[model samples]
Target: MMSFDLIGRLFGSVRDRDGRADVLEKLAQHEPTLPAPRNPSAPEELLPVALATKVLAGWLANRQQTLVPHTLNFRVLGPAQADLLLAVMAAAIQADGEIDSREARQLSLALRRVGAGEDEARRIGAMLAEPQHLGTLLTRIQEADLATHAYAAALLAINRGTRVNRAFLDYVSARLGLVPDVAGSLERRYRA
Candidate 1:
């Protein structure tokens, strides 16, 4: 419920303008809202699995909507969809030929947030370790909403630091059939 409310507030905040900074601030401020698991020894003590997934999904949707509204919808994704998203992100992170430490760390954090065990996360990582035909994967996404959200996730993962992975981004965008300007806008927002 708290996650749902947070997502609603996040959507409202981003509706009028580019509220990415605001959304990030809210995510940081509201992380404490996620309840701890019943098992004291659980790895995800800082954030609940469901809540974390919702937060990530909301952020992706917000990013997509802010940059390209027609293709993506701002909504929380279910667990299966989250797994697919993680796979896409993993592929994106590896798109540049080598996985940077920061990108690996980010991917690990995302996997943990979805409550993926080490083996499961490794499985997902292995599945995407090789260069993948992003267009084929995009087609398997079923819904336009998920595909767009996955695109946003890929963009977030790939556009790190001073240099942008333009070639890789362009390839994925072309595979996804995104307008050049929309993909450029998403890249620019992160670059700024």
Candidate 2:
């Protein structure tokens, strides 16, 4: 099941103000505790569940599926995949030559959400601090699920729709051996 919070974010920000409220209300029926986005910046937080919401949205788009908002659950990534996602997400943010404070914070929260251990987080941190080879980092992944999740996380981490990210995602999808449409689908859906 998806987390109600994540679901709320998924459905909440995609529409106009009244539409957003209607969706949030539907979500609140499932999760009474769901708070409206605190401020206008919250269209982003309208998915404060941001990373999860956006990531999950990408996942669904990839599979051409949908879910019940109330019965949602966030998939917890395993340690290795978590590290890969962190690296991928971090690299995506860094691709434009700088990491915005907000972008870094989203990945940090994702790191916390992934439950990456201290040593692992430190290692990934060191890795991120250096230059990255997007292709090389992806070579060890042989699983389709990991590839998809990694792509989604990286796509979500894009600060804005920069050309650098477009290129980076193209390279990442090729490295991960995803169907070419995966990156374009995600970019069109989320980043567009």
What is the per-residue lDDT of model 2 for residues 65-177, given as tens digits with 9 covering 90 to 100?
23311111124555566667667776787788988777677665655554555665576678778887766667655443467667766766765556776788787788777
Question: For every model shown, what is its TM-score relative to the native structure?
Answer: 0.46, 0.49
| Residue 129 miss distance in model 2 (angstroms) | 1.8
| Per-candidate total of colliding backbone pairs | 0, 9
lDDT of 1 by residue, 36-65 (tens): 656757666746877988988897867755
Instruction: Mark the regions of model 1 whose C-alpha exceeds 4 Å error after superposition.
Output: 1-75, 108-133, 142-144, 159-164, 188-192
Query: Candidate 2 — worst ten consecutive residues by lDDT sum?
Result: 65-74
